[model samples]
Target: MALPTSPPEPARLAGDNWLANCAEWPDLVRQAWRVEALGTIVTGTRWLAAEAPLVVVLAAMKRIPHAELGPVLADPTVEKGWWLVPLDAADHLSDIRQLRVRPPGWPLRCPPTGWQLCGRFWLQPPDGSGLVTAPPLLGAALGPGGPRLPAEAFG
Candidate 1:
């Protein structure tokens, strides 16, 4: 798969108006997004990236009250109403890798596993005007269904 040639858009928070406009988003579409979740509710963030424009919808979910979006986002440490930012893919990924190499809890972590660090990614495109199926990995693990979620189920 080819990497997106266009420059990444600036990071932005999907605010209240944004969420209202997307009230029908998840129901109207089913595109998968690649995202990274970090920090606690008061200061946590989610980074969502997709090949096409639907990334905006995923980011919109971040606007919901934590009590509502929390289960889906599934972060326990965070409080409610956390913020979401749409990241500049290339730059964000690069920064994350660099940080992993020198994380604050380095020695204690033993083997630094940067697996949480998202690199390049691709998501299923929206059909003419319908919800997409499961979001699948486009570059490295493209074969069948969407990218496999972790084995453990979210409660």
Candidate 2:
């Protein structure tokens, strides 16, 4: 399969979602991820330190109080360092599953739309051919206070 390709402006922070507050801090906003399939952009934050910045952008776009998305956006682990994995499309899919199944820390969810978001991602430098995969370190921050909300809430 071909690598995913997002729209040129996918990372545009002009939406009403939870991350509208990031506009003021263009530097932080620049690191946002453009999820090609989802057609939206999300800031790659390692902890809650980036929350204030993100909240600002989200509030502006959503035209609401940034506080509304606080709890979800306040997750501390998201502030940790990021990994860059290099893998073909097939390997990417496999690695995603391995990340979800092998490690309990994976923030796995099969949304009604049928797409999965590994809230916690793992990565590494490229291999000899400049291809590497970053798999989440399963239980790093997921043991107790991790980001995975209670399953009951979703049910």
Q: Write the per-residue lDDT of candidate 2 for residues 107-144, one digit (tens) a residue.
A: 21111111123332211111112221222212212223
Best by lDDT: 2
- Candidate 2 C-alpha error for residue 75, in Å: 6.3
Per-residue CA lDDT of model 1 for 38-147, tens digit only, reads 11111112232222223333443333332322111211222211112232333332333111111122111000011111222211111112121222212112222323
Off by over 4 Å in 2: 1-18, 26-31, 35-70, 73-155
Candidate 1 residue spans exceeding 4 A from truth: 1-14, 22-74, 77-83, 97-155
TM-score of every candidate relative to the true structure: 0.18, 0.16
